[model samples]
Target chain A: MSGSARVLGVLGGMGPLAGATFMQRLTLLTPAERDQDHIPSILWSDPRVPDRTAARLAGGEDPLPWLLRGIAGLEAAGCGAIAIPCNTAHGWFEAMQEATSLPILHIVEAAADELLRLGITNGTVGLMATSGTLAMKLYQGRLAARGYECLVPAEEEMARLVMPAIELVKANRVADSYAPLAEIARRLVERGARAVVLGCTEIPLGIAAGPALPFPVADTIDALARASIAWAKPAG
Target chain B: MSGSARVLGVLGGMGPLAGATFMQRLTLLTPAERDQDHIPSILWSDPRVPDRTAARLAGGEDPLPWLLRGIAGLEAAGCGAIAIPCNTAHGWFEAMQEATSLPILHIVEAAADELLRLGITNGTVGLMATSGTLAMKLYQGRLAARGYECLVPAEEEMARLVMPAIELVKANRVADSYAPLAEIARRLVERGARAVVLGCTEIPLGIAAGPALPFPVADTIDALARASIAWAKPAG
Candidate 1:
């Protein structure tokens, strides 16, 4: 192997399962005939980092210090670039980027890139994320900048459908999460969304528990993995 | 989260998928209602480490320097203990343990512990692993020390069934690996083995791809995960 080869760093544990699944996806997605052909990676899964949504929406402990600590840990371990799998955690993307010279792959940017790759540029896209991500406009701002409009669930819908579904996944009741999440995505498509973006890390797991949705859904976990892969293998 | 909480380090990337799956298993197997309740882990998945089986069987590159490099990196990153998921890689376990104060969980010993946990204290247990592991006597010595006899595939079965099945998993052809592996496991059971140990990390994946094996199977991936989890949570 070349000494100059990039080692991908995953700053995860926003939800431990999401972090683990992202690592699994990264390994499965990479095209490798042998072990050495796959990406070299370091996953720092510190689930103790205070809740991202709680910090964003309510009066909760700030997770920025923990995020920075993880970044520092990865950098010290010789990571070339970093990828944070959690969608809501990207609320601190700028602060994290400012703290390190290493490039952090943005979950929102990767989702937007997925939208473009799916030929949905300049179209209205439905987004399913935590209430905090919606309140912070993480996807709305990024998608809007990329010429895509985001239609999100109403507050009542978030309370009744979205938030509980996310909790079910965190609690490992994935099969039960599918119904509520799928219903909301269907409602979004009915309200004129061309595609639905599974914005939160847990949302895709919920959606996948059921049969495939008829509508196009961009999974951010997969989107982030693809972005990490792209960054790992630059054109020769 | 307590500052004194243990951080589990994984020395992975013998084959990237196995390493990634181990992380998934670790997260899923842990008893956690939310992210904070899960274990904190660092996965150093540098797939570029030279082949362990090749090094053991043929005049191939020594992987000790690379193994030591990973151990050093994890130690520097604040890991309290380490777990290596690869069965073949443990051939250099003594050398690795000598280089680091951090406790590296032994996969073979973990398997032995798992066998006892399943109430199979002293009996004929079958082991399915890479040629290197068998050649190095990693499992035989350890299992014998634990008062258990291991029945392994004959040399012809190793070439015809076991090795190919393992390779299929490595090459991402998990579904195709099931039949051959199951046939061999059945043969072992017929030859007086009580239960089969899926000693190679990839074997469990292959077994899982097909219908459930009629015989009881000890999955080392899960064994290693359980061992890692046990180390992460100490009785108060």
Candidate 2:
């Protein structure tokens, strides 16, 4: 069960697109020849969970029941490792990781490990994600341990900038959604971020590869993709 | 079953990385809430196919047997459409498409469709792919129908340039793979591509928004992703 073919499972649908992005990342990450070399992946992309921000701030319905159902299904199907593609879902992820026997891939741990390997120092990584991810401090908590800092849009910038773009995704207005991000990327450069992590998987959907503002952007989803590939690869 | 989930089943692993890139493109292209909201995808990434270029030149093993099995699996699983990520594999795709009852989303056709939408004409589309894709009429034949002029690397350029990078990928030597592609891209721009299609999905992995490249690059995988999303949306 822990070997090839039945390797990875995902608990997703925090926004469906992030999970979709992560799965796509999985496909690209595997090195294969015909069409069966990929590790078989079972994904539960359930978007019905109550908003994480709402649940944490004001007492709202918990997503635990739905998340556990997703876990049980994947476990029943014999998955070895688990991953949650949502950045905001990390609040529950700690609980989920502890509950599941499967080694869950935490994006925070994955990104931090990559930063360590890259020798990323006092350097600030510009984070672009949801209000929940920013406010909840999922990545911030783990990154603080590794001595790396996470920079985000200020209160005014986040409201006028990031949130609007996320709205465009929820609405499926993809092209229209990108303009605000392009503008915000300009401001983030002026603020001196060494690199930007498209922390939200949906953000990459909006970004076209270009040097609009400053510094290279490392997509956190792409980071997770690389991490997953590393995990899936046969150990030397 | 056809009411939703276009279900683009992929027969891949001329190289697994290529399959992964295609999945990412599919996810990127689909418009959805959680990953499940997009098309249901079943990927069979087989990495044991003979070197496509070598097989084309000499009488060697073919990928047809493997391709058929994967496509059959997709059909049995209720996939509505199928796509293979390898440019080289497209040589046999027409045969595979005919074998399956489901529609096969041709990546070349999809790219041309996007070009028409983008209003690209008169300029050349730089094609970065495996030698087999060029030798066979995989992209050229379909692109001709769509009124696109394809610009592929010269055979000498293919040997001196692109193959080295592909080998690096097989060896797991990433980061170094980008330099060869960068050099090749500059040459293609000088010869005449207005924009380059990282025709091979893996090339985009190499070409991800880096320091402004020598030319404008449109990842076919990106186009594939965007188009698949469009295909999944119920027409308004």
Using lDDT as the measure, which candidate wins? 1
C-alpha RMSD over true interface residues, model 1:
2.1
TM-score computed on alpha carbons, candidate 2: 0.63
- Candidate 2: docking tier: incorrect
Docking class of 1: medium
Task: Estimate TM-scores for all models.
Answer: 0.96, 0.63
- Candidate 1 C-alpha lDDT tens digits along A48-105: 9998899988979999999999999888888889999998888898999999999999
Q: Which parts of model 2 are misplaced by more than 4 Å? A: A1-6, A11-79, A90-236, B1-79, B118-127, B147-152, B169-198, B204-218, B234-236
Candidate 2 residues A159-206, lDDT tens each?
887977876664456677678887776677678776676676667666
lDDT of 2 by residue, B185-220 (tens): 888878877777677766776666256685467666
